[model samples]
Target: MAKKVVTIKNLEYEYPDGTSALKGINLDIFEGESVALIGLNGAGKSTLLLHLNGILQSDEGDVEVLGMKVAENIREIRGKVGVVFQDPDDQLFMPTVFDDVAFGPINMGFSEEKVKEKVRMALERVNMSGHEKRAPHHMSLGEKKRVSIATVLSMEPEILILDEPTSNVDPRARRNLIELLNGLDITKIMATHDLELVSETCDRAIVMFEGKIAANGDVEEVLTDSKLLESHGLEAPVLVRLFRDVMNREYIPIRLEDVIEKPNKYKI
Candidate 1:
């Protein structure tokens, strides 16, 4: 079995204004598992994600990442769990792409030579090589997103957390991002509404509803259940819904490649 990378038990959190963001959330994320946290706008997906790396601490419950308590070892845990926020601007504050990517390693006390090597490798991983000196502010949204991911990659985190990674990017950029994420080998917790990206990258699906976990299972099973998805203010991927509604097919196809492999098998 895969070793558990993160564990949350009876976790609950509330904002200063008495807004309950997470309630009784229990989750276990294993090493190397790409899990998608899916929910509506206020379903508390982001709230739960914040607890994973100690950004938000629950008063009533506990959270542990990489075998250390988030509350006590937050400084250490933050280095292990790299988070890329929804907006690239939130993550890319350094002047240039190289600076932004090197910040994480530098903060970890890496030597100048090591930091430079890390930045180069991370940029290459995200296919943003040769843009080191470019200012992030001048880059397009897609480019900014890639650089944002590279910043986290420089940390060489054991777990990668991304919030709405595909949001606001063009189709080609989205596709490339999906491919890039798929190539990475790490535990990933992605909170996103993009079912297409979820299907492409995650093997497990976690659906949150009103500050609690409504459903958790294999990506295909949870995403293919139109009733469960609709009840949670979500809809299945377009291809999955089409197979169910129009073709009246019993099995839902989540990826384009699956449909293309045997189009006649799904004939209406």
Candidate 2:
């Protein structure tokens, strides 16, 4: 059995202005699972991701990551779980790409050589190598986003969480990001409304509505349910809907890889 990397039980959160952001959210993310959180703009997805790394404290429930309670082991939890925010600007504050990527490992008390190795490995993972001297503010949004992810990857966290990763990127950048995310070997949780990204990169989907999970299951199953998705301010990915409704197909293949690899099997 896969170990549970993240567990949230009856999680609830409220803003300082008395706005409820999350209500009774219970979820368990197993090791190496790529899960997507899909919902509308105000659906608490960002708030939930914040709780995973101890950025936002829950008002009424608990979150555990890698068998460690977030409240009690916050420092350690932050080190073990990395969160990439929706906007790359929010994460990339260092002067250069190298500094941004090396910041985490350096703060973790790693030696200079170890930090350099981790930075190199992380940048390489994101395909941002050879851009170490580039200033973050001068890079394009897509490049900034990649460097931001590399910053977190340098920490070698057990869990990787991202918000709106595909937003504001070009088509090629989005494709590159999908491929990069798909190749990662750690548990990944992404909060996004980009159904295409979800279909291509994630194995499971969690639909949030009014701060609660409306649906949680296999990505294909959840995404194919147009009724459930529509009710929660979402829609099936274009490919899924195309095959299911227009192509008169019975079996829906959500992932691009699956659709391309088994085209004959999906025919009605």
Candidate 3:
């Protein structure tokens, strides 16, 4: 059996103004599983993510990561779980790409040589190896997003949490981001409005609505449910809608490649 990397029980949270953000969320994420958290605005997806790394502490529930309680082992958990925010600008504050990528490893008490190695490897992983000296603010959104990922990658986190990763990028950049995410062999929990990204990169889909988990299941099972998605302010992927609604096909294809590779399977 796969190890459970993150466990949440009866998780609840409310804002300072008494706006309930999360209402008794219970979830478990297994090792090396890529899960997508999909929901509309004002849902509890972001709030739920904040609790994973101890950014938000709910008075009502328990959150555990790597078998360690978040409330008690916050510092250690933060090191092992890296969060990349929705905006690259929010993550990249250092002057240069090298500085931003090296910040995490350096703060973790790594020696100078180790920090250099970590930075180099992280940049290489993101395919930004030769652009270390470039200023992050000057880079395009796509480049900055990769560098933001590199900053977290430098720490060598076991779990990566991303918020709106494909949010403000062109089609080419979005495709690149998806490929990059698919290549990484680590536990990933992403909160996104991009259903296409979820279809291509995640093994499971979790739908959040009105501060609670509306649905949770395999990627194909959840994403293909047009009714469930529609009720919760989401829609099936374009290809799924086309096959089920337009073509009136019983067989549903979740990803674009699925339809491309086996056209006869989806034909009625």
lDDT of each candidate versus the true structure: 0.92, 0.92, 0.94
Off by over 4 Å in 1: 262-268
True-structure RMSD for candidate 3 = 1.0
TM-score of each: 0.97, 0.97, 0.98
Error of 1 at 154 (Å): 0.4
Runs of candidate 3 with Cα error greater than 4 angstroms are none
Q: Which pairs clash inside model 1?
A: none
Whole-model lDDT, model 1: 0.92
Error of 3 at 19 (Å): 0.6
Residue-by-residue lDDT tens digits, candidate 1, 167-209: 9999999988999999999999999999989988999999999
For candidate 2, write residues 114-204 as lDDT tens digits.
9999999999999999999999999998888899999999999989999999998999999889989988999999999899999888889
lDDT of 2: 0.92
Model 3, range 1-268, lDDT digits (tens) per residue?
9999999999989999999999999999999999999999989888899899999998898999999999999999999999999999999998899999999999899999999999999988888999999999999999999999999999999999999999989998898899889989999999999999999999999999999999999999999998999999898889898988898988999887887898889873
